[model samples]
Target: MLVITVDLVPSGYEPMRRTIATMSISNISELAEVSDYQIEATETSNPLAGTPPRTVRCLIREHARAQSVWALVARASDEIMKADSAEL
Candidate 1:
């Protein structure tokens, strides 16, 4: 069995964290084809500017039964990376 874990650093705003989590959950649900994925808010810290920063953890299974989950994670990561590159 395998596992995929994604860590998110909130953009100095609680709402951003929630937004990202919601997007992630929806993306996982639609692409992963696994119904057992979970996302959790872990901790928060104050940033120098803007709102406080938050951290989130997403857990996804990567077993044979969850092949789609693995594919979804790969796709999501690819999209994120592409966006980051575009920003650079």
Candidate 2:
């Protein structure tokens, strides 16, 4: 079993991370071989941000791989991209 943590940089406009994954996604689907790994997101509020506290989201992913995970993810991303492009 392996764990892949995606840490996102905070945006200037907002103190919290975006809802969608912000990591450079060239190949990141094998960790989710059909969404293989279980995804967990924890949010924390920062009081110093302002009157309306800003909530931050942290994403964590875990998976098991018998072979190279990179290759798996790359293949999956390719398939997804192809399907997505076809919609246009």
Candidate 3:
């Protein structure tokens, strides 16, 4: 199993929050085929920030040749903050 932590910055916000996720596959050999990933994030509490917390649900398609898990997460984060993407 792999545990991945992703740091996210919501649009129009200063404070940062994180999303943690666990995967069943561990190591490059385990990913011999394309895989689908879903990362769900709930609203976080930011006492210092006046705006409401952001919620996000990211869906990513990871190719078998993907180099690093971090790259996949970065794509997801970019998608999450898009104006028409998964942020709620």
Candidate 4:
């Protein structure tokens, strides 16, 4: 299986949730050719600084299936990050 890790920009609470949901849905559709697929979304915080980070991991049985959605997800994710960055 192949694992794709997507690092999401730290936006405020609501936006972060929305971004992950959108990414997960789009990834599932875009990688529908894969026989087996799963997504894990997580958020963690730095103990000292209290900074939070989010990650969305997509796991697929075939590397090709993973590759097919990488570009699309990456682009969309970048757009979200850019928008969030600007708000910072």
Candidate 5:
């Protein structure tokens, strides 16, 4: 899966990253139980003054599933992190 970060100015990428970091399943799980958990944020860009420059917007999609989407995403993240850490 691929996720893109969008920002008006070039420096906005850090803030965007912070937002995603805060939304991590482990962080939210500390508060409430996130179930059915389908949340996807897509960044789309369209040319404004032509193809040279473009404007971007984030498209968020949230849906319900029989199983907890958060579970799957969280597990995947943990597994990936552990594998990477071991390699380090």
Candidate 6:
């Protein structure tokens, strides 16, 4: 069976990594637990933006499975970081 795991860069934030719930690809509830999980993971594991709440808002504004959503979030964060850096 295929599994979906959160694959964000480790930020020495072990708690967030440990708390991530591994979901099965076949599970329809994958999106359910992703809201808080993603927020915490993004805030702790990979803080690409200055304000974590704002960053999370920009990244995940809709419901999606954790695996897929995280991928998009990572990409968005990278772009946001790049843009922020370019402004300097």
Q: Which predicted model would earn the best TM-score?
A: 3
Q: What C-alpha lDDT values do all the predictions have?
A: 0.41, 0.36, 0.50, 0.44, 0.32, 0.38
lDDT of 2: 0.36
lDDT tens digits by residue: candidate 2, 1-88: 3333444457655567454322122224554443343222222333564323222222223334455768545544443333312110
Better of 4 and 5 by TM-score: 4
Candidate 3: C-alpha lDDT: 0.50
Query: Which one wins on lDDT?
Result: 3
Q: After TM-score superposition, what is the CA distance of residue 76 in candidate 3 from its true location, in Å?
A: 1.3
Q: How well does candidate 5 score on lDDT at residue 9? A: 46
Tell me the deviation in Å of residue 9 in model 1.
16
lDDT value, residue 3 of candidate 2: 33
Q: How well does candidate 2 score on lDDT at residue 34?
A: 39
| lDDT tens per residue, model 5, 1-88 | 3233334544666554432121222222222333222223222323462322222222222322244755455554444333312110
Rank candidates by lDDT, best first. Answer: 3, 4, 1, 6, 2, 5
| Alpha carbon deviation, residue 12, candidate 5 (Å) | 8.7
Question: Candidate 3 has which clashing residue pairs, if any?
Answer: none
Residue by residue across 1-88, what tens digits does model 1's lDDT show?
2334434557667555432222243333444434444443322333454434454445544313345655656654444433312110
**Residue 82 deviation, candidate 3, in Å?**
1.9
**What stretches of model 1 exceed 4 Å from their correct place?**
1-23, 27-67, 84-88
lDDT of 6 by residue, 1-88 (tens): 2344544435976655553223332223344654322221222232454443222222234434446745654654554444322111
